[model samples]
Target: DAMVIQNPRYQVTQFGKPVTLSCSQTLNHNVMYWYQQKSSQAPKLLFHYYDKDFNNEADTPDNFQSRRPNTSFCFLDIRSPGLGDTAMYLCATSRRTSGGASETQYFGPGTRLLVL
Candidate 1:
């Protein structure tokens, strides 16, 4: 089945180290979403890309960056991961209709980051 795939289900990084998480979709969706979810908290939208255009949330930190080279791939880069940055990073993909409405998003299993 076509789906979103995230690399390295688990990640470990040292304090102030750089880390990157990647996602790819086989469904050929137009929009891809990146989310951060901490334990016991709802997932927060960090950023997204529609085609090649990037959209970031107002409260997203500068430490986080994203890139989408094509419709199928997206990447999240944490420039300097802190202990507080340890959380689950989720990737999702959705198709936008001609009327400008987006369909349901399909999420990958997620990559869990552990900062040490």
Candidate 2:
């Protein structure tokens, strides 16, 4: 089935080390998104790519960055991992309606990160 896929379902990284998490989809959706979710909190939208155009949330931290080189794949890069940065990273895909208001996002299982 066509769906979003996130690699290395679990990750462990040292403080100050850089880590990259990846997402890919086979649904041919027009948008791909990355979200950061901590325990007991809602997932926060970090940014998204609508085709080649990138849209980032205003409150998204400078430490969180994303790259979508093509339609099917996207990556999240953390320059320096911190204990507070540990969270489940979610990847989602969506397609806009012609009216641009009724779209739904499909999310991957998510990749959990643990800071050491």
Candidate 3:
């Protein structure tokens, strides 16, 4: 089935180390998003790409960055990993239909990061 997929489901990094997470999809959607979710909290939107247009959430930290090299692939780069930065990174995709409504976003399994 066409779906979003993330690599290296589990990652371990040291304090101040840089880490990169990746996502890819077969769904050919126009919008792709990255979210950071901490324990017992809501998933926070980090950034997204709407057909090459990049949009970053206002409150997302400077250390968090994203790149969508093409329609099917996106990457999340943490410039400097910290202890507090350990969380589940989720990637999703969706598109607005001709009916002028947004479709439901399909999410990947997610990548869990551990900082030591």
Candidate 4:
């Protein structure tokens, strides 16, 4: 029963509208990550918070942002969702307390967004 939970598996919005997707984990992991995956392509890392240390991928667009206000919860915010922005938003976590790197990341089922 202890796992990540994401509200509303599907989201539909108009282009340019702001949208938010949420994630919460019961794993008590120290690192939480957000990824954007489109059409079965590789999940692109957007950003992550490692114990309040936020790391964003270099090429990730400015339209994407994240907030991890607490240990258990994280949110992905799209300032302006575009048609090309439609994708599955995935949330992941790792304990990663031993060092700065960990290969195993537990992922949420994901939130699918459709921009019209």
Best candidate (score: TM-score): 1
Worst 10 residues of 3 by lDDT: 94-103
* Model 1: pairs clashing at backbone N, Cα or C within 3 Å: none
Off by over 4 Å in 3: 98-100
Q: Work out the TM-score per prediction.
A: 0.98, 0.95, 0.94, 0.95
lDDT of 2 by residue, 1-116 (tens): 99999997999999989999999999999899999999989999999998889999999888888999999999999999899999999999999777775378999999999999
Candidate 2 displacement at residue 44 in angstroms: 0.9
Off by over 4 Å in 4: none
Residues 16-109, candidate 4, lDDT per residue (tens digit)?
A: 9999999999999999999899996999999999989999999999999889999999999999988999899999998875766775799999
Candidate 2: residue 95 Cα off by (Å) = 0.2
Worst 10 residues of 4 by lDDT: 95-104
For each of the candidates, give the backbone clash count.
0, 0, 0, 0
Clashing pairs in 2: none
lDDT of 1: 0.96
For 4-101, candidate 1 gives per-residue lDDT tens digits of 99998999999999999999999999999999999999999999898898999999999999999888889999999999999999999999999989
Q: What TM-score number comes out for model 1? A: 0.98
- Give the per-residue lDDT of model 3 (tens digit) for 1-116: 99999987999999999999999999999899999999989999999888888999999999998888999999999999989999999999998687756699999999999999
TM-score of 2: 0.95
Total backbone collisions, model 1: 0
